[model samples]
Target: MLTPSKVLDLYFLEARCMLIEVAATLDRFDRAVDSDTNGDGGDDRIEKLYESLQVLSSKSETPDRSEQLLKLFSGPA
Candidate 1:
């Protein structure tokens, strides 16, 4: 197994890049003219996106954040 330092060294930049990309994508969505919040403009996938972001940020008993997000997205359609 890689040491903590090694893991960070190997994955930090890539992870940071992905994080930036995700943020950019969300920002782009918010900027779209058709994304007006006049009514029920959101759906389950958007809700899940935010929920998964929360899962990614939280400290929980589950060590694997991806798995938690997967379950969150996969549960009950």
Candidate 2:
């Protein structure tokens, strides 16, 4: 029932905050990687984060990104 503008008006600030938090986390991670001595910067979890970010940015017709992200972060059953 919500129009596109209405949806943005309701959720834009929250969504923007989340995005900023994610970016900040990534920046902190990059700093850690730069300061790490052993050079083992990333693991499977980091890879999953990167993949989830990709999913968020994908230009698919269907609005299934949240589903894709949920599955991406899920553990083995």
| Best lDDT among the predictions, by candidate number | 2
In lDDT terms, how accurate is model 2?
0.91
User: What CA root-mean-square deviation does each model show from the true structure?
Assistant: 2.7, 1.4
Where does the lowest 10-residue lDDT sum fall in candidate 2? Answer: 40-49
Which segments of candidate 1 are over 4 A away from where they belong? 33-42, 75-77
**What does candidate 1's lDDT look like per residue over 10-77, in tens digits?**
99999999999999977876676376767555567777888889988888885899877778868586
Q: All candidates' TM-scores?
A: 0.79, 0.87
Residue 23 alpha-carbon offset, candidate 1, angstroms: 0.2
| lDDT (Cα atoms) of all candidates against the true structure | 0.82, 0.91
Estimate, for each residue in 1-77, the C-alpha lDDT of model 2 and write its tens digit. Answer: 99999999999999999999999998988999999999978778878888999999989899999988998898886
